[model samples]
Target: MTQFSKNIVSVSLWITVVILFGSLCNGGKILVVPVEGSHWVNMDILIKALHGQGHSIDVIRTYNSWFVKENSTYYKSITIPNTKGMDEEFVDDMLFKMINYERGKSQLSAVQLYSYVFKAIHKTHEMICQLITNIFESAEILKTLKEKQYDLMLTDPSWGAGILLAHELKLPMVYNVRWTATGEGHFDVAPSPMSYIPITGSGNTDKMNFFQRVKNAFFYLLMDIQNSRFNLPLYQTFCDKYFHPPVSFYELLQGADIWLMRVDFVFEFPRPTMPNIIYIGGFQCKPAKALPHDLEDFMQGSGEHGVIIMSLGSFISALPDDFTEEIATAFARLPQKVIWRYTGKRPSTLGNNTLLVDWMPQTDLLGHPKTKVFVAHGGTNGVQEALYHGIPVVGIPFFFDQYDNLLRLQERGGAKILSISTLNKNTLHAAIQEVINEPSYRLSMQRLSHLHRDKPVKPLDNALFWIEFVMRHKGAAHLRTESYKLPWYSYYSVDVAVTLFAVVLIFTLSIFLTVRYMCVKCCSRKRKTE
Candidate 1:
């Protein structure tokens, strides 16, 4: 009991010291949540930095992992609701379903693949999941306002209910946008890559790859269905009660006071940006740590051949057989050892040089001295991990803004992008070779790593400071944009512009008909009188 007390006291003192430092810095009640998968890891970092600064943190958990430090207070809004066991169950079920689905397939179909995904999210029966997340998350944010009384709420742009609740409670909110390609359509914001930026017009005009375009269409279609079933219902209720109608889709992010992109200029494409969109790249890092045991063994055992680390990220880590087979075929030709993080049955054709595991210590592996190349699906957290360790990449971007990330990496000469559709042994082998053999790739990557790590006060410091500043100042209103206040039709000018065009066309046609009618009538009267 005494030991526990001492530990608590030690933590309290540490918090006091950080708080003292932070008070000299800024003030606010801080609430953080991440509904998007492993992006929660970034939230963990924000929580630590804020807690260290001695600010009260209301960490609302919506996923499996929560690593709040000792003596820190937290609230769980809606959990992915799956305990670790539940997560395992989800994976196991998904893997089995995907495997069987692929069993009879000759080639992979996008519709079938995504259908399986929809089945998985629904199977989780996320009704209670969403409600719990919304209620708890809202409760935590409201509680913080009521207790420490927040000046602002720091949350992801689309983190479950954080966005909605912030608007509901009328709190100042800072939006942490993790990727860059979250472009104009996303609340008419400027370009910021998830982990990188890209060249762009007023908004990003770069066309997506086939897979990405298809995925975008698919998501949009799904959201359209959801908008009707769920969003419309909720929107109507709020409008009826509060007299403030919710803006349509793509107008959501504009509601926040600020949107902070967790990305870097060095690694991203150049693009026009708004003052409201702040770039806080590589915000999800801690001081470099030593490599883990399994990673060290994998690195040292590979010798000069080095290792190719492949991960589809947390979302697609469970390799469907068709995707898995495609990867297996690619690695078979490579002379280098491939350490693949695949949660699937190993293909019989897989070579001795390739190692398949259910999971990987990705950060530890990246940090190892012998690690050569990283093949990723190009998510923000994974990009940060790769850049942090100076590992050049082979980006097999599957969906969303991953294609943008691939573009940035390629522009820097630090990586290559292989279309997942076109990826096979010959293409992947060449990409791996080009990334590894090229000294420029290594040099470029190291330079980026240095730039990413050189920020003053660190991202954690910035996030913590902002949190406290919000509490003290009641949400730093000067930072927010009033874009969200505009209605969707007005914002897009779709109704006004379209209506005007239609009216003009009709007016011109009506004048032409009137003139013709007058001519005919005058001629008929002259003939009758004659």
Candidate 2:
């Protein structure tokens, strides 16, 4: 045969092999229902990774989605039209109220604050429930979704809408979870001891005194009440209407095949975990890429003192004018150059050393050699990225789980937490200076980074393996625990404990009665003889 013919035949064989291999790895369809804002940021990373693996992804987004765009190269979008969704305005309003309350500028009492939060959560959940209701009621959307025949449903369980959809379609479910509808995801599927495992909003660490433990218990109770009163009832209404044989929303949430938990023990306190819960924390983080020309020049200008980067995550672009002034004044006192991500009015106290921008390349800046300390809002993505890059943090937490996330780093000696209520120029500057000047903070964080990085496979790769494993096996039922199906009493063994106690009591009572009868007979005979 001619050399040209041989080359053609060899190339054809290689192409055929490649096609077969791709077919074997591909052809799995995933229906993703993700939460908005930072949760969407995490979900987007996973979606892109999944698409690279040749899986077809269909994402569900509300018409008012703040981040999940209608158009994307990696995934097809399924937009639901909802007039009232959790948009930026809603978040900003909440933040404003929360800040006012925290700073003692509002007339809201503690009770009022609790009431406001409850109402806000209730309203949000009601909207989500309605959105899910719309999906179910729409015959065309349901038909299209059912026709897609997705292999699995991958979702963030921060909202329970995805859980409802997964159950409705009878598809295996996987969670990209840190928080669930009720609280943190671990509490649902794992053994979370209230004695040491601190509740989300509680400022206590794993080590707690008696009073701290009491506070933790109270926080847990408050969360449970919120779940029962605010979150569940709204979703339960839908459950009653649509489900056959009736299943609680919590049940559907706990019955997922896999939970790709977004935190590892390196960042999280040591707590009990279940078999199916995979820690894929820092999966969204990567080695630093080249910064834009302008950013690189700024980094270079920082010189030996290094650069300090600050961001308040995706949601809060601007704080109150007074708060910004306080922060800017603090930045002025620092020797290191500052890159502050702000959209507020320029603070008059701003110094020549500080640079203000509407946005920043956050992860890349953290990864830079010249980067010294991170001034962050303590969002999970920012926290994980800082840990991934071995950078210490000066955390200024606002609302939600941000405080708890920062507290974890503080407990680990990698970060310092400053309260927004008490944050002034002096406090902010002190916190930043302490983190910068102290070598221990950087050492502790670098140690954590080493531990986080010391693994056989990358976290993203591990997550993908488990995701595809579910698709391959139809579902990971074997790894899933049956404890979720058990009632609360049964799960805690309360029934068994009660039963055993009753049996022991009955046995002891019978013996005592028999002995008493004998004693009475003997006494009667002795009296007659006398």
Candidate 3:
């Protein structure tokens, strides 16, 4: 080769290296609007992955967000000012009240459910509005965000302000929800057939009777009405006041690049889905690590009877005294050792067989060889972990999707649902015994665990690939469906049905008139002849 050609090649290679290095060093700038509550912890895996991959993340959250332990150079967190009613104490108190309300009503009627939901919804709206208002009011913060030019806005749709922020900044959004997306009123993201897919926490399944379908339909209708009447108006008002060209609030949801829902068909029933929806269930969960020495010793102490881990998630871990007493009594009867997560006052009736801790390493415990079953409230994350480890369960569901989650597990023969309102020592013990005695429960969970693990790609990688894909393609609009483009009547084919009926009616009338005319003409001719 000539000297000139060799020199040219070397120069080109160096230039290419410089460009590629720069691109790798400066990845996409992402803006996240995460929940300030316990739910914030759920985003830890995804956010941490993005950071580790060198993506710059700027999170706008409430003050003292539990999401951050220490400040990170890779990530920037800006706390919204004037935020109130977002403290752990407040959260605990509200949850306690909700538990009491459910206990008062053994089973919630539609009216009672609506009443509780309405109050909760109303309160949530106020807090969201206030936080949003704070963000807009913070001139320095708003200016900084605009100047940085974020590539994407990843948010939880439960917070309406996040959607508004995405719109105002002209950034594409991707929803990251902890639960099954449909239960959280993310109907536009995916199609959930009322005939089969039951509402979460409804204690109904995909296989419903005719009356059950009607009831489920009514429940969904009521929720929609509530959203439109209360939630939508508030969101619209915020947008109209803050945004430049105010668009329909719901339209933005349709325009999302993707929806990362924590749902898997292995545990859930198969249903209709859209192209933009991605089920990254159990992404947050990892292979459980070694238990603490103390925990290991405790599990080993159970011997042949095995240990049952009881942690009702963060929301309801601080259960009432009476409930704890009954649970304690039930545990005392069992040969198995119990580890319960409790945060409030120690129950006087707590038995020697039970070990109470402020926080329990639930996933690690579930994975332990000595751990036989999980007694939980059926939170999505907890249920996924239990199912992942192939553990049978005693589900004492309290509220929200807890009931529905347990009911599904029960149907699969891997769990038993015990109502919080009607729970007693005898009932709890029997429920636990039934699951422990049945070998089918363990077998079912093992099958499900295998199915869950036998996936083509790791869930985190799947999530990251789509996220980076959106950044590269500028929202990947091609993946979105045309369904969102249609109006309500057209989407449901109501207009098509009505138009067809009109055409058929007109055709029938025309035929009838022609027949009558012919008959009349024939009769007149016959009379003249006579």
Candidate 4:
């Protein structure tokens, strides 16, 4: 044969092998139900990554979704109509009320604050339940969803609507979870002791004193009450109305095939975890991309002083005008250039060194070497990115687990928390200065970055592998725990303890009676001889 013919044959053979391999790795379809705001941000990243792996993706979004776009190259969106779901207005109002309470501008007492928070959360969950009800009531949507035959249901369990849908569809479920319908995700699936695992809003660290433990337990019970009183009833009603035999929404949540937890031990304090729980903390983080020319020039201008970047994540467009002025004034005093993400009116105290923009490439800026300190609202995404880039933080927590997130970093000596009520020009300035001047803050954060990076596989890749593992194996039932199936008393071994106590009590009483009888007979015989 001619040399040209031989070359053609080899090339064709290689092409055929490649084609066959690609066919073998063809991706499965995924149905994603995601929460709005920052939760959507995290889920979007995972969806894009999954799409890159040749997976076909379908997203279930509300008609008025705040972030999830109706059209996307990566996924087909199923928009549910006639539902007043969570939107920008809802979030803004909640943040405003929270800020008012925190800054003592409102007449709300501490008890009122809890009441307001629970009420707000209850309203949000009520809206979600209504949305789910709309979906279930619509025969067309349910028919379409059922016809899709997705390999798995991936959802954020912060709302129980997704959990309910997954159950209705009878698909193996996976959670992209940090928060569940009740408090933290781990509390739903794992053995979370109140001694160390601090509840959200509790502000306690892993190491707690006696009073701190009491506070932690109180917070846990409070959250339990909140879940039972406000959240569970809405979902339970749905279960009762829809299913032949009503299913517990909490049980379905706990029985998920896998949990792609948004935190690793590097971010979280040491705690017991299950085999099906995979840590993918910092998965949304990536190496710094080249900044836009304007941003790059601004960063270079700082020289040795470096830059301080501030963002309150996606939800808050701007703080109250007075708060912004205080923050802007603090930024003005810093020798370091400031890039503040603010959409409110320009602060009167703003200095020449500060630049205010409506939006920012948060992860990219954090990854930059010139970025020394992150001034954030202590959202999980921002905190994890700061850790990934080895940047210290000066956390200005507003509400909803933000304080606790910063508390973890502060306990590890990487960040400082400033309450919104106490935040002012001087306090904010001092915190930024303290974090910048202290080498330990940067050093501690860098150490965490190293540990977070030292994992065998990248967090994103690990998440993808496990996701595909579930798809390939149909479900990860082998890795899931059956403990979730047990009733609360049985799981806690309260019944066994009660049984053992009863047996011991009966044995002791019998021995006492027998000894008393012998003593009585001996006494009678002695008396007769006398």
Candidate 5:
């Protein structure tokens, strides 16, 4: 072949090879440690999905600890130390103070009064500086986490403190918010009017009852009060530190490059949302074949009827003869077998059909065909799993975002709730029966489950792609805003502009008056001389 022809052929081959290589590198490496409950579980699954797609992953978590069940292979598990416990009260104080400060109101309460005392100890310290310090200091768990290198961060609000590490390292960050990002804390504080930036919703199509909606409103009010009083000042200071003299709420949230939502579009009906956010519904999990041997046997032993799975959550237990008795009494009349994730010793008498274990693979057990209903504490993790399997639930929400999630689920016509304070056999049985006999409820859950599982890409894949995207883009600068960089006044600049306008007006008026005085004096002098 001619040398020119050979060269063209080689160049063509090189171009084709590069295109092929680019197509092959579809998935990206990621490092994530959402060590906090269902949030972490979903995060871990996402990391694994990346690994499945032939991308490298490193996860940080606690190792085999009973409290967190912390261990991972696809990614290194970074266990953050809880030595200082946490400043929940301090956080709340900070939040409350920021709320009232924004309205330009006085009369300090709660920790504001305490902050005055605390401020005495650190007269040299600035609250905004302290808040930024908290973000960096939140990596208190990093002593254990530094063992691994991460390119990007995937965290939840509960794990928001973890974002401090990413901030300190100047890593690109994307947060997964499970509840309303902002709101009043009347019914529940986590999910509120402020949940979404544009302030619509996840578009779950599920609207709460009038009372539930009212409760949501109440949550936002409390949030407004607390955030306006506490977080706002720290936020404003953060803004001033970065943007220099001006900040807005919109700018504050826009600081993060991306925000993943724990909402299912199938559930949200019609709510506006911003471009940076994506809702990954039921990313918690999907059915995976049969249950483990013992669990499957236990389910079959339930006789003619299917079984009921009751779990308060990983944190709380079913121990104490008291709570056990409530379960026993509730199951007494049921013909179905009951398998409870028992934390305490066996009650003196568990019903003949009942089986109790310290813990069972919840998703595994729920996937069983014989599994009919879920008696859950209404945590986001458990809720997502149950919805994934199309299992109707009798919610007994304990705390956190559990109550709000349950309310939304019940409103959607799939789940029913019994108050934890008023829990008993009658209430339990009623909820169980409703979930079991209601075909429509089953249908609602199944339909939603399909949509949740029907994503263009698995949540894990999506997460991995973003993580790699951040690494490739060197931390998405386009996604970040200088809201936190500017001062409150400078952020708006309206005040600054108005003040400048007034100053110029006054200066011009003074110059005109002086010139007029000189002219009149000169004219009078000339007239007298003449």
Candidate 6:
């Protein structure tokens, strides 16, 4: 062939190859509306993973979010006006006060917390409505979403606004959350029997005694009542104001295509799960990256004694100074090195054996050979990571699911739980030593880690597949339980139970009346004979 012809042919071949590759990718446009704060970390993994598969992903999040990458991005970010605004100081303040409130005054009882939360629902609903209003008021933004023609929505249930957006846009949505699923919550798409599925914050276990079960049941009913009285009305009002021909929030929730729960059987007790609830636990976690030179050197320097990594995540990083000092004093007495993620004033009691930083690569440190144990606030992300790395924990849980997760870890024999309210240097030191000294803690963690890893497909891959599966099928409506369509009475079988009760009552009444008549007849016969 002539040289010019050869060059043209090669160019054509390259073009054909590129076209074929693009066709094979078969990417779709995906929209992700993450709940604010560090939750973006979990959203980041799925976003990047889907982006890697050549899908176009767009996110609507809080302004000045840490997840906002500057340039050369696989996804586009749209900042929306939120209650917290650009300054994160308020968030830190709230978390600090919350933790202190629980830790100082003792952890609030389930009823107290529920009542408090119930009272706060209206404010929360208003905040969420404001966030959604900001987006809806902008014709350009709504127009853009319409123009993009997104195939599916991956929503954070914590935010509570994404479902509304999905409904407004007439798109199928998948709910994802890190919170433990309490059956009493609005997202009761499946049956969570109060018998085994412990109440989210009741501090009850799967194996509950009679009194504990009673407490669990009370908490469960209390939440449902709270939701019906407070949350449902607020959501209905929001929907009515925004969307035409009002829809209840529960209706929107039940219409969800699937639920991607960040729960694992390794930490949670085996409970019946619905077809639509997918277990993508640890999807946020990745293979540990190489630690920074300073951290690496610090771990290596620990030698035989090893190191313990402590972090309360972004939300609770700013712990009270005095509170942290108590922890620091305990760390000082330990033979092992301690790396604590502290944003507060450096503790004066900090020991020579300890290192403090504003942030540390948690998973990386946990995965390190020189790392012995993790002392954390028992956040779900931290708990999952510790389990994944087979590192036992000294859990000082403060609030929410942390307490429940710590209880599960303790039951599993992979952790030692300490009450944050009563925390002192001595208790902290003792708990830390117990986890470290107990060989069973490490062994139990290793066994669970093995089970976690022994899955048919990697969690990340499984997550990615299910996400795309929803896109391909438009919506996984078939996967939804028939219970979603049933009324409350039918869903709980209250009607069936009542009918059975009535039947038994009628039968017993008939037998009693017949025996009474027989006795009367016998008496009458005896009197006539006399």
Taking the tens digit of each residue's C-alpha lDDT, what string does model 1 give over 288-370? 46766766676678888789898877766455665677678878887778888887677867888788888777887787777
User: How far out, in Å, is residue 88 in model 5?
Assistant: 16
Q: Write the per-residue lDDT of candidate 5 for residues 398-445, one digit (tens) a residue.
A: 544566677667777778888654667787888798789879888888
**TM-score of model 6 vs. true structure:** 0.87
Ranking by TM-score: 4, 2, 3, 6, 1, 5
Over 1-530, each residue of candidate 3 has an lDDT whose tens digit, in order, gives: 89999999999999999876765676899998876544666776688898776788988776655445436666788767567635665556656666666678336564675586677757867787888888788888789889999999988776677787888788988878743212353466667788988865455788999999988888888767777787778877877787766677777756778888777888777788777888888887788899889989988899999988988786654667787788889998999999988787787877888999998777888898888889888888899889899999889776667777777788887888887667889999998888888899999998889999999998888898888888877797888887777898998899999999999999999999999999999999999999
RMSD to the hidden true structure, all candidates: 8.5, 1.9, 4.2, 1.7, 10.9, 4.3
After TM-score superposition, the amount by which residue 148's alpha carbon in candidate 5 deviates from its true location, in angstroms, is 8.2
List model 6 lDDT by residue over 365-385, tens digit each.
889999889988887788899
Over 154-205, each residue of candidate 4 has an lDDT whose tens digit, in order, gives 9999998889998999888889999998889998889999888888888888
Per-model TM-score versus the true fold: 0.67, 0.96, 0.91, 0.97, 0.66, 0.87
Residue pairs in collision within model 2? none
Better of 4 and 5 by TM-score: 4
Each model's C-alpha lDDT? 0.63, 0.92, 0.79, 0.91, 0.60, 0.78
How well does candidate 1 match the true structure in TM-score terms? 0.67
